[model samples]
Target: MGSREWSIEKRSDSFKAEVLETLSETGCLSVIVLGASGDLAKKKTFPALFNLYRQGFLPADEVHIFGYARTKISDEELRNRLHGYLIQEKNPSPQHSEDLSKFLQLIKYVSGSYDTEEGFKRLDKEISQHEILKNSSEGSSRRLFYLALPPSVYPPVCKMIRKCCMNKSDLGGWTRIVVEKPFGKDLESAENLSAQIGELFDEPQIYRIDHYLGKELVQNLLVLRFANRFFLPLWNRDNIDNVQIVFREDFGTEGRGGYFDEYGIIRDIIQNHLLQVLCLVAMEKPVSLKPEHIRDEKVKVLQSVLPIKDEEVVLGQYHGYRDDPTVPDLSNTPTFASVVLRIHNERWEGVPFILKAGKALNSRKAEIRVQFKDVPGDIFKSKKQGRNEFVIRLQPSEAMYMKLTVKQPGLEMSTVQSELDLSYRQRYQDVAIPEAYERLILDTIRGDQQHFVRRDELRAAWEIFTPLLHRIDNGEIKPIPYRPGSRGPAEADELQAKAGYVQTHGYIWIPPTL
Candidate 1:
């Protein structure tokens, strides 16, 4: 369908069912971000919260923000560090400056140790004071604790929050916790982590975030699949040849190798982000659009995926990665990996779902390419005919386009590739696309688990990749080395060829401009 015909306004009814409930029940809300001085807080968490405030999503006077960390810095100093990262471009308008100042006024800082109960008690005092000031009429006050810290501290932080920071009574507002990705290195660790947190809070109160689920394009997958009838019949293995979900980053991890080296690219991206995207692409239609219903379908697809074969996987480490001071000298971590997943379901029994992700590659992009089966019979004798392919771009630009073969615009009557495109920049020029974190944070505030990962879903995903991960970690396999600016290891190309993926040379995608 064209962009104009399938515009959000035109299709609002189809998607609106998922957002039936509102979050108006919560009264004065207090958001406390742990590891406030960390990179994740400064880069994503604070900026997303500020965007929510600037857009008037949060009640200006009633809502309060607290930054908790071990660093001994004044509130003004913390705000100063955050101000540079907030969405203020060079030479902003006076109104923008005023809005930023007002948002900063709501944020307060609390310095404390994660393991110490005294610090948490003091932090709770700060929150309680704000609750008393804003919610004097006995209305419930909501508390949201965002753990922007590492996984090592998650257990202690959860314990401390339950002991010292949880809501005093259910009569008022309830409390929620937001956690970031890389849930664990393996299945056992992930389950252990979940058990630790499950003892303190219910599953409904824990938001295991996968930012990829919040992306505009990723969120649109449901609308494109279930809401649009044009794709229903052609979405299975009968007509589709293969599906490729690829993620590439142009730059290397310069100073962040300490964290990246420990997790590697597979644990960092493939296990969580790319795998979530695969579930969306291969899942069956849910009975309803509710959070749990959608998640139930996602889990089914992951369960059907066969264990990844060792030969079907190709791992590579970027050249000169050891040069980074943070990376261990003898580290054999893989910066890139391509693995094939076969779903043994009725809908996708024979189709191959190729998941490839890498850093320090030839380009920066994230896309899903679904190649369809060739035409049963052809009348035109053209050597340049291309298979029908549906492409969804998730980053660098957001778009959905289908490549089809059409007669060339001449008397020669040759077939050439053409597209029916829906570029977001061109179609929704005036709308400001919210960041992934922004959408996810709002979902958490509203208690919407549709876009977040469930505990069982996390386990199912781990079950599919944990065995392969163990093989790599046990030194049973070694990663091939490839140049920083190259595509990836040469073996990756050979793997694609064996899987029957055609490479059309000299074809490039140009992102649409606003």
Candidate 2:
């Protein structure tokens, strides 16, 4: 089938109709962002909304933007704060300035407490006012409430939204909630959170957003795996040696350790982001690309993963982390962690999946490295040559490249490693790559759950890491110290070595920054 037809086939008839209507007509849509004064709102949420507006993806007159928080800020102040983050480059064009002014007019702010009914009632009144002003009484108005707040406030906020802010079902419009992750600290907590939200909304109405899943490279994993003939036979235990799903950041939290300390590197990055990538890399092909069908495969792969052993884990905290004014002096929170997972299924029984994530590391990168096993017998005496590797760099310049051995250019019979690269900047230079938050927010607007995590998938993911998390917390496992600029704890290298990963000595991938 052609690309357009295939895409239509993937979506439900109702969803296709909705998309068509949204594109062709001006519908009443209100996007209410809770915790608007926070960094996440300014840095990501508002910025994404503005981009959508600038691109004409959002209706000009029929849509409204509401920002709610406990802070007593006027709409002008909120817009000013959001303006700096809304795509104004060092040298913006006159059209960009015009677009910014137009986008700012759509946003309005409301001061409110998350737990109180009165505040939510006021919010509801504000939302309804827009509907009334647009003369949408006869037409339906969709409401999307984005919870940009912390997990601690999720229950009360969700309750408030359900009780006071939800749209009436009789009005023909629907209500959807977009939740950010660290879904819960553990499996039980996650289930409880899910149950609470489930009480208010159905499965279809809840979108568990993970920005990583919205990444262009991550979204491409399925297509790269299934559509490419080269990868089909090589993506198995017999051919693949080990997979390394790594996330590294060069910068430490500059006095912003409150949240990071509460949920260490494991809960912060590995559990949700890296594991989601793992599922995509290892999952069996779904029967179709339907949301539930794709999620079923992800759940299956997660279920097959055996509990990670303590011996296979390495935890590290960057030196001077406790010295951060915001971090407690006695904090044992891990700024870095590397753990090995062994899937017990037939296709991947012996292969080790190493998940590594860290803050204050050597460089900023998030990449999946799949190292294939070496040839049984080499004819050219190239045993020293590294095993083949298929790498998908998720961030810091998205790209995919395969490392393979080839004969050296000289008369010598020696081999050298070369890459068949597909750097995004080099290939799709003119195309704009949307931010993760942008794509995810757009998906939520379209009511597409394929990129969002399902409740079962969330639970299964937590199940894999919760025990290890508890052990680290209960046992107060002291993380080894590594300097802020270093790679990570020395033991992390040892852990990888023990897990059968062969690091190439001379080869390094320096991604092109465009």
Candidate 3:
């Protein structure tokens, strides 16, 4: 529903200017995968492109993919590395092998250093040759550069692209870059990175991707809140007591201990992934579904968030984390964090938005739980059953359910807990949820910014967490120790209880089956 062109009646001059700068969807496509030899390109980026290939989104004649990195591998070598990474279909067709072979043939590899013009010049030459062969000699080609690389190298890589690899075509041809996150360590660094990149590309030309926004359940949030009349009148502080956005992983950072320690749980999850979720759940309805309109509301909500109070946060490090040779012996980095964010807006005044995330916990799941306020005058004593909670489970099984108080099915008139469940597997048996990267990459191709992070939005997010992160970096704050395979430090639960969150005991959600 959101992919439509802006309503002609509501077009602003700025919007018209923005639309003109984007590439024509009909131009020849050149997709360059930077850091293509790395794990991300091999596992996610290439696989996603292949999916688009089989679905005919990438016409064999018009789309050519280029793998650019310093790995010094031949095109055939790169194809062989990626062949095993693509997820094979459960059942294959007679022509599946032939289709796979053809798709592999379309990719070319360009080897070079990220900071030098030598590599980028070669990349540009290859792309230009392809464009000219396809009748786009005058620079009428669409160029997309995906950086599946580390944050430390983004500056030089971006500079090289800006210097030597941008498209020369002016007739509806354009160049855009997609960056993975950890945009920076804090507000100061994040602003600097933004400024550095801003000098090279317009905000519209930079796509800052956060994969969580592409999740099937997260994408449904706006429609679930705004399109349903039943929720319109009951979604504010008056009806809701506390909101909990939680992410838990059953295992430790396996082989990522060294990398994970630099940016703790808060940076890894809460700041980008969970906070974006909070904005969608709490923002007012947009004027229209236009990308700018939707993003504008998100920025406003983030700006309204108050500073973090030290007393409202709990940090923990798991027991066996230091065992990883990569982790420093005296590291105080947190593997778990539960933070309360209070928005100063009228819709959520005095309500606590708890953002919790952790690694090496009791289970693996990401979810949002909205617990409604208790009944004013309790007639059926529903308090015994528990406060009404609306839960949106994001993974393991994609589902949304509302826990309500209802009478037992027997002659007894007592209230009991019940749920109105909508499990995606049960309800849509024939549909396969697209991988988050696949949907996001498609959005980048279609020139949709609704699901991508905006610049000011990134700034506001950093503004909320930078001060707290600094305290942790210094010795002012220390992470409490907790055992692996257990819920985070007990202090976290105490903090939750102190903040008006009442946990409902003895109730679990079980997905309904065939």
> Which one is best on lDDT?
3
lDDT against the true structure, each candidate: 0.88, 0.88, 0.89
Better of 2 and 3 by lDDT: 3
Q: Which ten residues in a row have the lowest lDDT in candidate 1?
A: 15-24
For candidate 1, lDDT tens digit of each residue in 450-488?
999999999999999899999898877789999999999
Candidate 3 weakest lDDT stretch, 10 residues: 1-10
TM match of model 3 to true structure: 0.94
Looking at model 1, residue 284 earns an lDDT score of: 91
lDDT of 2 at 357: 93
What is the Cα-based lDDT of residue 340 in candidate 2? 97
lDDT of 3 by residue, 1-514 (tens): 2322233323433643443334334568899999999999998899989887775567777789999999998999999998888647666665777778898999999999999999999999999888878777565688999999998888899999999988765777779999999899999999999999999999989999999999999999999999999999899998999999999999998899999999999999999999999999999899999999999999999999999999999999999899899999999999999999999989999999999999999999999999999999998877866899999999979999999988889987877888999999987664557788888987897789899999999999999999999999996889999999999899999999988999887688888887
* Selected candidate, larger lDDT, 1 vs 3: 3
Poorly placed runs, candidate 2 (over 4 Å): 1-20, 23-26, 170-172, 512-514
lDDT of 2 by residue, 323-374 (tens): 8788888888899999999999988999999999999998899999999987
For residue 51, what is the lDDT in candidate 3?
83
